[model samples]
Target chain A: MDFFIQLFTDPVAFWNSHTLLIAQIGINSIIASSMFIVLYSGQLSLAAPGFMAIGAYTSVLMDLHWHTPLALNLAAGVVLAGVVGVLVGLPVLRLRGVFLAIATIGFIEALRLGVILNLPITGEGLGLKNPTADPLGGINMVLVSLAVVLFIMWRLTKGRLGAAWAAIRQDELAALSQGIDVARYKMIAFVLSAILAGFAGGLEAHLNFFVDPGDQQYGVTRAVQILTFAVLGGSGHFLGPVVGALVVTTLPWVFQQAHDYINIVTGVFLIAVIVFRPQGIVGRGGLAIVRPAWWPRRARVSAPSPG
Target chain B: MDQQLLNAIFIGSIYALFAVGYTLVFGVLDILNLAHSAVFMFGAAITYSMVVNHGLPFWVACIVGIAACAVMGLVIEHVCLRPLRRRRAPPIAALISTVGLALIIVAAIEQGQTGSLFAWLWVDGPNSVAFPAGTIPNPTWHVGDLTLEASKVAIIPISIALMLVLGYVIRYTQVGRGLRAVAENPRAARLMGLDVDRMISLTLVISSALGGLAGILFGVALSDISPYIGRDNVEVRGLAVIVLGGMGSIPGAVIGGYLLGLIEVLALVVLGSNARGGVAFAALFLMLVLRPQGLFGAQLRERI
Candidate 1:
């Protein structure tokens, strides 16, 4: 396709023309990282969009009412999002698996339909206008912030906290037996994820120059998109979701000709990836999943252990 | 209040039809079939096409629609579920796949109806389709101050009859025994010589059929249908019903459906319709937090 040819032949031009695309990728990558934390802790919490909305509205409201500095506003947004995450996580963390997923979905819909759509300050679903929005200028900030967040996440995963999270993910009962405090570690991961989503939301609102509380903006649809990032990329490693975000965001541009059929392709691709590579695109090792677990371990395997 | 109660029962019965199918699948497989909503929408569309376009009798249309839903269910189980089941994948994998399947089916429906790029693949599609005429009539019955639509009485009885039949089958039939056995413990059922696979397939067929019935009845109630109606109209409310009824309990589903129906209607009266939608979900959230077992279900014990 010409799109591919243009990208490869004129890299600089591609970058220049696709500045918005690059920035969007950066924002989505941050949100993907936010998704990674909750999944890493074995919590299937679909509460990222809810937190993102909180962050976006909080920062914008601050700017509108008190004319706070951007730094202060963003910080307040992130912290408040984390605090609300804690409050929401406390009651919700009791549930696991599908129950947790549905509950979080309920949280998102209730927040959007009840609070965001009803409140006049949010323009009652008509959306908000950000006069001080820096649409073209925030790309640098997004890139920098994404870098910092990824580095922090990578470093965090290499620590004892990360070890505890892995243990919990592997088996919650086993984690509790080891005195790892399952609830606390899950809450920490959830709150950290909320903070990342909040930060991403604030940055995204700035770039868009509006805080539209649309269904697709802060609803189940966005939650599903964020989930796809982690699933398609492979949730095992930090890099998986980042790559997932990159690929998923760019796919539309790449497949411009199949715009109408794009949803069908994405759907089929999602199903294929899930069926073929349950571990993900960036998961550990190669495509050969002929491990001992596939068959019964020690089920008369004449050879040595596969691992 | 009597009139309002009649209204709630009518609405709730339709929701219960969809909800029970949802819960039935969940009960046996322990995975949410996200495509069930699409199946529900498909049912409505199929019924519309049969009676309106094909000029079939209403009863014939209902049979065709229900049969088609069963086939769709079987396809979903085989395509989306069987592979994952064999691999012993997590529950979320199945959920994601179903969501993906939902998108494809819904998109196909849209393309088919609109006669987009592939005209050959077209079926009824994206826009709102009016319910076929001469199927059901709406007539009010009055006795003193109490007045109610005749269709409401009929609709509520249909739901109750379906629920009663389902409960009886699960309690009495040979296939029902196999279903319960599998639901209780698949491995144990397999060891006991029960056909787990066959039972699961049957569950899908029966459940999908319920969804078909719900879709047609809902079309009659609303007098029209849309492709996008699944998410907001049936899926969410069906979920609320199952959760409220106690996830796997059949009777719980019935009571929960009517209960939520009453709550929605009364809440509309008190808070107005604008806030009513949120109030229902907010109630579901609060209920989960307060009584995660739902109103009638057993206490949840954490499984290792």
Candidate 2:
């Protein structure tokens, strides 16, 4: 009880205080929402982190190397990321399903390796350091960036492109027959989502004041966590990825606060969701109570040592 | 010139093994098991633990780990994949699930701390683990001017034997015939009273076990084991082998693996270490653009 009280009184406490938890939720919600824009189109991209890396790295490079202003750098990062998306999407969006997945995986891997190869550009994986100023300190910049990107995404996804994305995702053959250019719609989805991801990455880099090749979070593990969040939260709706991201990002933190076995808990959660709740936490419709037969109810709950 | 060629063959043989497993799974299921590399990692780490940490014999450790992967493969099929199949889930769902599963495995291994990557898994590290010189003691085998280590000599012949056995198993066995049936048409196979689910599960199990073996051998040559090594390079090489040889063709995987291996080695010799991975991938990208169906793969019939 004393620990909890002291935590609340601590300056770091506000970041986790019950009242401020809403802010954290809002920030995560934005990232998750952006994820949904791609997942909705049947593209479970593992390149979210890579897009972020691009945004972050480009921002830092432009700011330091070219002496660009913060706002201009941010815009450049988003635009560059979108352009990359379009370029990659043109040839790749033609491939369906696993082929596309593999191609994207290849893209992320190559980009990461490229960064390592060109050490002058990416700081040789040691990372770029302290690339931004505190207009209102570090935390506010993250919140403001999140809000702006989320607003843009929310508006765009609720408009014309979102419906087209839904149509293509539901049945590509039918969508094509109905005169929807499947490839074009997919490109839009990819580019738009990438823009948001890039923006997010830029903010993250500045906040942390460092950027590494590994910083892109395009790693297989992070991709899976993001995917799990989108699926669990309900990709079909606006708030699905938000719900998913919030649960995934924060659950580990909460668990870590109490014990070391966070991964085991998360793994069990993942297995359970896949087997029993494929639609995820915010998912609706039928099969809500029909527990899957394959998933064992008795999960192994063990406390893991520190990572 | 001789050293480069031998090194390529030595490295390529392991790739041949890796490619074979991937091609087998893709050939039969038409699904890319993205987690295949993770399975390979698990195999290496588990085997390493048994041998290095627990003091089991190397061969014993390898066998037990391979068996463990076979079981895990079966479980993956049952838990992650079977539902998708039952509902005829979209290819995207399977792809997403596999990617997610790959992350889960990587994280689980990271949590264990045993499979953490060494800088030299593919990149430069403090000291590249090298097998001691003259450990074999036999005079190096000479193919013209090419000098081959005893271990290197073993790879091609052993690979041939393994491939031959696999070929026989697929061609001569009843289970193989059922697998062929399902691969050709799942619905048709089911209509013919074949246990489609079981065949799919069996395919994953066998492929993952083979992948497990490949990982162990790879660790020996590299003189290191790291979870990060295989995912991209192995997948690209496997896919390239399949594309160049033909998808769903086991013989193609073998031929393509060696061809690719040789090409990469020659390129590395001419180009440099830094450009090796890039050159390999660039060649694959070009191959994909030029001949998507591969040299031997029959063009897939378009679904209406």
Candidate 3:
């Protein structure tokens, strides 16, 4: 009605805080979706932040060092990050679970350290500045981009590659035994994940109008947060990360209004989720609310009936 | 050559202590406990508060901090880990949740303490504590004039004693054997009537205690703590040790720690401190590339 008209035509009439909040939502959605690709493939690549760092750096370099067009710079940023992801994944895919987790962490650390040492380009530990505002306009562009990316991701996951990746996640050896090329699937997932993360990073750099090593920590921390969202929403489902992201991102704003007990609240909620309902809010074995047709057969049958 | 080697050993011992805690949890439960570094930092923070604010003795503060760390580890096991185990949570969930726990810890600590207020709470300002810098001021046992410092002399004995005690506990203690059994096969151990959950909790407690010990030592060596001691390169170093030493081997932990420490120190000595971070990361990358299973790890058995 009036809200939709205002949202598109007179969006500026809305409160600045609300606009920023929506922007935040869009940004986090990109991050969550980027992370979901790898989770789908059965890997927890903790180095999402490292790739984000690369993207951010590349964008900054393009803007400052070369003064390139925003579109070109961002494309290059995403591509560079994907290349790095491919390189990192090649060696680490052989590792499983905790080993892969550690390796990815190491990858992040290495890149962060490299940025620190390479002061001439990366601005060293002091961090880089001189960020410009988003060229396509802030909230609108982000919203449009998010819709496109989500649609693309949704389509991708429904295709053959998605099934193959899921099989690899379920059982890598079994997938290989069934003639699925595990390494190629892993690499595709890695590169695709990195590209999305990098794209988000590039957009964020323009949104924030600056980049720094500190921002790398944000990426790393958010990557973990995004993974939490996926798990909390049931990573087995396509819409899991998105739903989880909406809850987690919005929860903080709600808590912010109160200001007190933020950490205690977040900490307790996280603990409860991990302990009591590790399958997550909408997850199987949780509250067997109307079972969606998409719910896996094994999960649906295993649900404990609530008398 | 002598000074560099001694520096390597000094740094190596510290990393070795940190790695011991990380490796113990990995070895016993096959869980990385991503919150471990935060726990380590908490130990140092607790010690700093006790020593500087409460005027407690150093050793007493260290013990109290370690005890608290053990309790925290147990709490994490009870509150976070056990439920996940029962629910058969995916490994990714476990890892991410722990990391979230870490973020919660860091944010809470940051907000509560306002780190800047306590940044200089325990600094020794001008009278810098000194460790033996050179190989020997005057080599009494002059092995070709290669001198050694008094601190260097102490490092070997302390590390060796700690390792031996750890080894003895793991080899002879019933609890230790139960931990090994749980790590090898949780279902089998469960059927054998071992309390799997309790054993896992004990593993976390032991690892946290070791981390606390390392924290106290690191504070002593660095001469300052800012509630951010374990947040930096240490966790990465610890993870590297676990990976490079074989994912779950204690001896591998020690060897990996020392080797990484040596590589880092040598990189610093030759390349400059500015390059140390890069060197540490480069070493980790090489390790990942060369042996994904780690130096002491056997090929991982793929789960059916």
Worst ten in a row by lDDT for model 3 chain B: B124-133
Q: On DockQ, who's better, 1 or 3?
A: 1
For this target, which candidate reaches the highest lDDT against the unseen true structure? Answer: 1
Extract clashing residue pairs from model 1. B112-B122
Q: Which candidate, 1 or 3, would have the higher TM-score against the true structure? A: 1
For residues B78-190, could you state the per-residue lDDT of candidate 2 as single tens digits?
76788766555445455556655765665555545334342112222122233234323445577777776665567678778888888888887999888888888889999
Ranking 1 against 3 by lDDT, winner: 1
Candidate maximizing TM-score? 1
Decreasing lDDT order of the candidates = 1, 3, 2
Q: How does candidate 2 score on lDDT?
A: 0.68
Instruction: List, in the given order, the native-contact fraction of each candidate.
Output: 0.51, 0.06, 0.44
Query: Using Cα atoms with residue i matched to residue i, what is each candidate's TM-score against the true structure?
Result: 0.92, 0.83, 0.85
lDDT of 1 at A228: 86
Give residue B23's lDDT in candidate 2 (0 to 100): 83
DockQ winner, 2 or 3: 3
By DockQ, the best candidate is 1
What's the iRMSD of model 1? 2.9
Which residues of candidate 2, in runs, are more than 4 Å off? Answer: A1-32, A133-136, A215-225, A257-264, A286-290, A295-307, B87-89, B95-147, B227-249, B284-291, B299-304
